[model samples]
Target chain A: MRSWWRVLGVVLGVSVLFVGAWAEKLVVIGPWSGAEADPFVAVLDAFKAKTGIDYEYRTMRAEDLSKVLPAQFGAGMAPGDVIFMWGWWIAKFADHMADLSDVIADVPFAYVSPLVVDGRTVGVPYVVFVKPGFWYRKSFFAEHGLKPPTSWPDFISLLKRIKAIPGIEDAAASGDGVGWPLSDTTEHFILAYGGVNTFLGLIDGTIKWESPEVRAVFENYLIPYLDYASEPIEWTSALDLWWEGKYGIYFMGNWITGMVDDPSDLGVFALPGAKAVTGGPDIFFVPKYSKNLEAAKKLAAFLMSKEGQELRAAGGGKLVVRADVSPTAYPPAERALMKALEGFTLVSDMDDTIGGEWQAAFWDQLKLLWVKPGALDDVLRVLDEKFPKG
Target chain B: MRSSPRAEPRGKGEGKSRRGLPLLFWRSSRRREEWVAALGFLAIGLVLIGFFVIWPSIRTLWFSLFDAEGFAGVRNFARLFGDREIVDLVRFLRREPPWGALLHNLVWIVIHLPFTVGLGLILAVVFSKIRSWWVGIARGAIYLGIVTPLIVGGVIIRFLFDKHAGMAPQILGALGAPVPWSAGWTAYPETALLALVIGSIWLWTGFSMVLHSAGLSTIDRELYEAAQIDGASELAQFRYITLPLLRPVTLVVAAMTFLWELKIFDIVYVATMGGPGGASNVLALEMYFSAFRELDPYRASAIATLITLFSLPVGYWFARRRLRR
Candidate 1:
C-alpha cells in the first residue's frame, strides 16, 4: 500500500508540472464565416506547429464583426488579436485597429496604398477582385454584324443592335433581380462621366446626388441597360443567356470570369475607359484589445511574404500589394481581361474612408434614382440635409 | 397530570447535558429547509434573469443615446420622430397595410394557428381512442416536421416552390399557365409568407398535438359515458365537456403562436432576406437593419424596446389567466 501511494504521488507531480508549462491560447476574430476563404485557419495552424502556441478563432457576419468587436473589447470579452475586414467595414472601425507601419514596410507600395487609413498602414493586403467593363460574345457580335463599342454611346448602339435581333434576348438583362450589376455600372458611369474626383466627392460628403454629371451619368449609363432589361431578367437567366450565346453584353467585375470562362472558349472586354477604379486593398486589422497582438503581427507578416502570397494566388485571388507582380500574377488564361488592356487610366474607388456614413447616404440616394425617375431632386434635397456642404 | 409526570428530578450535571443537546438541534433546524428551497430557487432565478434579460436590456438602452456627433441625448429619438420617411412608414399602421409585413403574420396566426391547434386536438383524441401501428405512423409523420429544424424545412419548401422544376410549378404548368410564384412584388411577398406558414404549421402542429394529447388524458372517460347516457350528441359532448376542459391548452397554444409571430425573424431572414424591395420587412428585420446594416444603434434599441413594451401587457394577462385556470 505504501509503494502504490508513492507511485500515485509521482504521477500527480508530473501532471502538475505539465499543466504549468501550457501556453495561453489566443482568440482571433474576423468576418469570414460563410463562403470566403478561411486564410486565418490555414496560416495559424502552421504558426502554432512552429511556435508551440495555440489559437481559437471565432467569426461573425461580415457586418457584425465591426459593430460587435468594439463592444466586445469594452465589455472585457476576449478581444481578437488579428482581424480580417473588407475595405468599407475597416473604415467604419478604423479607430480600434492598431498601426502596423513598422511591420508592413517590407510590403510593396501597390498593395500597401489601398490598406493605408489616415496615412497609417493599418493591415496587410491579401486578396482583391476588381470590377471592370464587360462585352458580349465576339461570335454573336460578328453574326449580328456588330462591332465592339469603344464608348458609352457605341455600347448603347450595340444594345440597340441586340434588341433589333428578333429571336435573340435583349442585352444581358437583370431587371427584377438584386441589380448588383446595375448598381456597379451606375457607380462606374458616375466615375466615367463625372470623373473619379466627383465620385470621391460623393464618398467624402462633398457632392450632392442632383449634380448634372450625376444625373447625366444615370440617364446615359443605366437608363439604356434598364430599357434593355424590360423582360424582368433574373441573374441566373442572364448568365445562362450569356453562356448560350444569346445575349450581347454585361458590365461586371473579374469575379464573373468564372461564369464567362469555359473549358471550350470565351470572349472578354474592358469597360470603355472614360474612367476607371484604380486602387482598393483587402485589409486586415489587429484589434486594440487583441490579447495576442504579437502573434497576430507575426501571422500578418507571414501572409505578406512570398510564400504566403503564393498561397493567396493559389486560393484564386489577385495579389494587390506585390509591385513586381503585374496583372500576370496568375497565368494568361486566368488573367482578367482588364489587366490585359493597355492605355486604360486606373483611378481608385472613391475615398470611402473619409467618413463611413457618407457611402450609406450615397447608396440610399442612388437607389431612389434607380427606382423613381422623378425622385432625383428629392433625393438630392435629402442629401443636402444630411451632408450640407456636399 | 404533566406536573406529576415530571416530579422526579435528575442530577444537575445530567440536566445541563440534556439542555446543551436540545440547544444544538434548535440552532441548525430553523435554517435547514430555507437553505435548500428558498435560497436555491432565488439563486437560479437571479442567474437566469440577470443573464438573459437584465444584461441585454442594459446594453440596448445604453446604445440608444448616441449619434454621429457622439453622445447626443434624445437626439436619435427626436430625429426618428422627425424623419418623414419613418413617419410615412408608421402611417401604414393606421392604413390598409397597417402592421406592414406583420399583417401577414397576424393573418398567419388567425388562419394557421387554429387549423394546427384544431387538427392537433382532433388527432390527439383519435390517437387516444385507437391503439395500433397506425397511431405510431401518424405520430411519426407529424413529429417528422418537429424533428426537422426550421432551416431544413425552409430549404425543402424552397425546392417545392421552385419556379421551374418545383412540384407545385410542374403540376400547375401541366394544368394551365404556370404561375411564376416568386416573380413580382405581389407574388413574392405572398409566396414567401405562404411558404413560412406551411413550414411553421407543419413544424409546430405536432408540438401542439402532444400538448393536447396530455390535456386529453386528464379527462376521465366516465364523463364521456355520462354524456352519452344523457343522449348528448358527439358535437354537443365536445362543445360542453371536451372544449371547456381543453380551454387552458388552447389558450396556451394561442399565446405561444401570438408570441412566435411577433418575432418570426429566422425563417424570413433565411428564405427571402426581407426582399422584393422591403415587402417582407417585419419589425424584427427592421430592428436588425437599423442596428447592424444601417449602423444606427439608437433606432434599433428603440425598436427592441417598443417590441418589449408591446409584449408586456399580453404576457401579464397570460400569467394572470394561466394561474387562474
Candidate 2:
C-alpha cells in the first residue's frame, strides 16, 4: 500500500506540471485561415523561437469576431489572448480592450489613428491588404491576346471581348456574400467616376448616397458593363470561377495573391484615371480578459516590430504599414504592385471604416443594384434613408 | 375494540390547532409528502426556466427601451415603425418584392403555411389508406427533409434553385420556359423569397405530415364506416368524420407551424442571408443583423420583443385550447 501511494503521488505531480504548461500557451485568434494564415503563423513561429512562449492559432471570420467578442467580453471572458480585429471593431469595443499606447508608442500616431478611439490607443497596426483592382490569370489573358485596359472605354471593350469567349457567360463574375465584394467593385467605379473628394465625402457623410454624381457612376459606367443577371457567388467561389476561366476578371483585394495556388499566374490592375484604392491595416488588440496579458502584449509588440513586419511582408500577399520596413522584403510581383500603388492615393476601406448600419445598408443596396439595375433610384433613396446625411 | 396504533387519534387541543391553519398546511402527512415530492421534482426545471427564458426576456424588454445614447424611452420602438429596413410600405406600394424584412416574413408565412399544412394532410390521409411496403419508403423519403438539419436543408435549397446545377432551373429550361433568373433563383429579388418559401415547404411538410399521421391513427375507423353506411361519399366522409375528429391535431400542427414560421431564422440565414437585396429578409435575420452587424443591441432587443409579441397570441391560444380540452 505504501509503495502504490508513492507511485500515484509521482504520477499526479507530473500530470499537474503538464497541465500548467498547457495553460501557459497563448491562444491567438485572427481572420486568417489556410494560405492567408501561413505568413502570420511564420511570424508567430519566430516569436515562439525567440521568447519560448508557445501559441495556439485559432481561425475566425472577421465578421464573426464582432458578433462573438462582445458577448464574451460581457461575460468577462475572451476567446483568445491576442485577437486580430477590424479597426472599426477595435473602436467599438475599446473599453474592453487593453490600452496598447505603451506598446505602440514608437509607432506614428497618424498611421494608428484608426486603431485609436477617444484619445486611447486600443489596437496595434501590423500589415495592410490593398483592394487594388481586378485579378486575371496571365495565361488566360495571353492566350486570348488580351491586355489590361488603361481607359474606361477600353475596359468595357475588354469585358465585351471576354463575354464573346465560348463557354463564358458573364464578362466579370461579381463576388458576393453579404455583398461586400460587389460593393468593393462598385466603390472602384465611384472613385473612378465620382473622384477622390466624392469618395472621401461619402465615407465622412458629407456627400449623400443619392447625389447625382454617385448616380451617374451607376447609371452610366457600371450598369452597362456589369453582368447584373449573373448570380452572386461567394467571394472564394468567384475566385475559383475566375481561375477556371469561367470569368475573365475578379475584383478583389491583393490578399488573393496568398490564396492562389501560383502567384505568378495572377495579374492585377486598377481602373484607369482612378487615383485612389481602398486599403487598411489588419489591427490586433489584446482583450483585458486575456489570461496571458503580458505574453499577449509581448506577441503584439513583436508583430509591430520592424523585424516581424519584414517577415510578414516577405511572406507576400500583404504590405507592411511600417515605412521603416524595406520594400525589398516583398517578392518581385508584390514589388511591382507596390510600385503601381505609389501613383494612386490610398484610402481606408469605406464600408469597413464606416461600419455599423451604414455598412450593412451599403452592402445591401449594392447587391440590389447588381440584381435590379433599374432600381438605382430606389436603391439610392433607401441608402440615403438608412444612412442620412447630418 | 381498541384503536390500532397507526390510527391513534390526536388530542382535541392539537387537532383544533391544526384545523386553525390553512387546509394545505393541515393536510394529512401523506398528502404533505406528495406535495413535497412534486415541488422537489419541479424545482430544477423552474429554476432553469426562470434563469434562461424569463430573465433574459425581461432584460431584452429593458434593453429595448434604451438606444446608444441611453434611456430613450419608446424611441427604439418608434424607429422600428419608421425604419425602412424594418418596414417599408412605400416600396410595397411601388410593387417591389422586398418591401422590408417584416413584410418579407409575412410573405414567407402567407406562402409557407397553406402548402405545408395542406400537403401534409393530403400525404397523411393518402398514406393511411395505402397498405403496402412502398408506403413506408415513400413516407420515409418525405420525412427525411424534417430529420435533416435546417442548415443543411438551406444549402440544399440553394443548390435546388441554382441555374446551372439545380434541377428546377434545368427542368424549366427543358420545358422551353423563359428562365429570368440566370444567376440562380436565390440571386434575384423577384425569385429569392419565393424560392426560399418553396424550399421551406419541402422542409416543413414532413413535420406536419408526421403529426397528422399520428392523429389519423388515434381516429376511430368506425366513424368513417358510419358515414359510409349513411351514403356519404369519400369527400363528405372526410369532411364529416376525419376533419371533425382531427381538430385537436390540426390545431396543434397549425399553432406549432405558425410559431415556427414566425421564428424562422436558420434556413433563411444559411440560404439567402435575407438578401439579393433584402428580398428574402425576415424579422429574425434582421434582429441578428441589428445586434451583431450593426452593433445595436437596443434595436435587436426591440426586434426580439416584437417577435415575442407576435408569437405570444398563437402560443396562448394553443395552450388555452389544450387546457380546455
Candidate 3:
C-alpha cells in the first residue's frame, strides 16, 4: 500500500508539470483581423519559430479596446497577456500596464516619449502608418492629363480641372466615420498653411484653436474648397469612389496601400509647402495581471527588435519604427514613402495624441465644418472649449 | 360536538391568538411552509432585479453628479443642458434641420409615431376585409420586418439610401429630380436624420400592424352590421366602432413606440454613427459616445439618467391607463 501511494504521488506531480508547460502559449489581442492581420501574424509565426513560445492571437476592434481593457483590468483580469493599443489609451491606463522601459530602451526617445506616463514606460512602439498626403490613382491622373500640384494655387487649379472631368463629381472625396477622415484632411491643411509650429502648438494647447493662424487655414484653404468637396462617405466607400474616378484625390493614411486593389497604381503627395507629416506608431503593452508576464515581455521585446520589424515590413502595409530596420524591406510604395519621410519632421497624429473628449469633439466639429462652412466660427469655438487645457 | 378548525366560523377576533395576533401569524404548519415556498420563488426574481436594474440605475444617478475633475455637484447637469450637441436651440431657431441630438430624437418620435400608427391601422383594417390567400402572405411579409433584428434593419437602411446602387437615388435620378445626395442620404446633414426616421417607419409599422390586427379581430362583427342597418357609411362605422374599440391597443402601441424612440441606438450606431456632423445624433448614441469614446463616465451617466427620466412618464401613463381600464 505504501509503494502504490508513492507511485501515484509521482504521477500526479509529473502531470502537473506537463500541463503547466502546455499552457505557456501567450495570448495576444490586437485590432487587425483577416487580410489586415496577415503581416502581423507572419511576424508572430517567425517569433514562434525562433523561440518555442507559441501564442494565441485574439482579434478585437480598435475602438472596443479602450472600453474593454479598462473593465478587464478593473476586475483584476485581462483578455490577453499583451495588447496592441493606441498611444493615448496606453497613457490613460498606464497604472494597469507593465513598465516596458527596458524592453524598448534602444528605440528612439521621440517615438518612445508619447507612451510614457508618470515616469513609467508603459508600452513599446510598434509599426507606424503615415498620413503622407492625398493618394490619387496614377492611371486616372495620367488619363486626365493632370499633374500633382506644386503650390496652393496649382492645387486649386488641379481640383478645378478634375471636377471638369466627364465622370468626376467632386475635386476631392471627404471620408468620414465618427468624422476622423475629415479631421485628418483638415490637419493636413493646418500643417501646410499654418506651418509646423502652429500645428504642434494647437495639439499641445499652446496655440488657441480660435487663433488667427488656425482660422486663416480654415478660411483661406479649406472653406473655398468646401464647394467642391464630396458629401461625407464612409472612408472605405470613399476609397472605392476615388479608385473608380468619381473623385480626383483622397487624403488618407499609408495603410491605404494594403486596402487598395493594386499598390502600383497609387500615387501620393503632400501639400505644396507642408514641412511636417502626421503619423503615429501602433503601441503594444503587457498587462500586469498577465500570468505569463516573463513570456509576454519576451514576445514584446522580440516585436520591437529589428528582426521582427523586418518580418512585419516585408509583409507590406506597415513602416517599421526601429531605425535599424531597412526601408528595402517594405514594398515599393511604402519604401518610397519611408524614404521621403526622412526629409519631413514627423509629427504624431493630433487627435490620436490628444484623445478622449477633445478627439471626439475634433472629429465632430470637422464634420460640421464640412457640411456647413458658415458654422466655422461655432465649430472653432466648440473645439477650443473642449480642448483639454491644463 | 366540537366544530372542525377548517369549518369553524371564525369572527374578526375569534381566530386571534392570546396576544391578538391574526390567524395567519398562528396558521397551520402547512400554510407557513407554503408562504416560505412562495417567498423562495419570488426571492430569486427580486434579487436579480435589485442587483441588475435598481443598483445600476442608482449608481448611475450618483455618478452623474460628479465631473472629470472631481466631485462636481450639479455641474454635469448644467453642462448637459448647455452643451450644443444635446439641444442646440439657436440652430433650431435659425431653421436648421440638424439641430441637436435631443431635437433629432424628438423629430424621430414626431414623424415616426403618427405615420407608423396611422399606416398600421389602415393596413390592419384593409387586410381584415380581404379573403384572398395573398392577404396572409402580405401580412407575413410586413411582420417580417418586426422579426428581423434592428441591427440588420440598420444595414438595410444603409443600402436603401445608398447613392451607388440604392433604389431611392436611382428612382429620383430617373424622375429628373436634382439628386443632391451624391454620397447617399445618410451621408448628408439635411437628409441623415430624416432618412433614418423614414427607414425606421418601415421597420416598425409592421409591429403596429400586427398588434392592431389582433385588436381588430376582437371587435364584434355585429357592431358594424348594426351601423350598416342604420345606413352608416364605411367611414362612419370605422369612426364609431373601430376607432373606439381599438383605443386601448392604440394607447399601448403608441406608448411602447414612444419609449422605443427615446432609447433608439443600434440602428443609428450601425448606419450613420450619428454623423454627417451629428445631424442624426440621438440621446442613447450620445451616452455611448460619452462613456466609451470620450471616457467621461459622469456625462454618460447624466445622459443615461435623462433617457430614463424621459422614458418614465410615458411608461407611467401607459401603466396608469391600463390599470384604469
lDDT of 2 by residue, B1-325 (tens): 6544346466653444433344345556768798899989999999999999999999999999999788989888898989776788987888767878888888888888988988999899999999999999999989999999999999899889877667887787787766454447887888888889999999999999999999999988888888888899989978888888888888788888889999998888888888767888889999999899767799999999999999999989987887998
Deviating ranges (above 4 Å) for candidate 3: A1-26, A49-56, A106-114, B1-34, B68-75, B176-183, B225-231, B320-325
Give model 2's DockQ, 2 decimals: 0.57
TM-score of chain A of each: 0.74, 0.93, 0.91
DockQ of model 3, rounded to 2 decimals: 0.47
Q: Tell me how far candidate 2 lies from the true structure as C-alpha RMSD in angstroms.
A: 4.0
lDDT of 2 at A158: 92
Instruction: Give the TM-score of each candidate.
Output: 0.74, 0.90, 0.89
lDDT of 1 by residue, A72-178 (tens): 75675435677666666666666667777777777675534645679876666665556556545667776779776798677777778788887665565442233
- Tens digits of per-residue lDDT, candidate 2, A305-341, equal 8888889988998887777877799977688788877
lDDT of 2: 0.84
lDDT of 1 by residue, B50-117 (tens): 99999989887677776667787777666655654333456455432213444555656777778788
Instruction: Give the CAPRI rating of model 1.
Output: incorrect
> Could you tell me how far off, in angstroms, the CA of residue B8 lies in candidate 1 after the best superposition?
18
In Å, residue A272's CA in model 3 sits off its true spot by: 1.1
For candidate 3, write residues A1-390 as lDDT tens digits.
Answer: 999999999999999997887578899998787777889999999989999898999998667677787778889888899898878888777899998888887765344353778888898778887898899999999988989999989999998999999888898988976678888888888888898889889988999989998999999999987888886777788888899889999999988888888898989999899988888888788999998999998998888888888899887887887777766888898877777677888788899888887887788778768877987887899889888858
Give one digit per residue, the lDDT tens place, for model 3 in B1-325.
Answer: 6544556556774554343344556676569899899989999998999999999999999999888788888888788889888999998888655587899999999999999999999999999989999999999888888888999999889888877767787787777766445447876677788889988998999989999999999999999999999999999989999999999899888998899899999899888888766789999999988998877799999999999989999988987887897
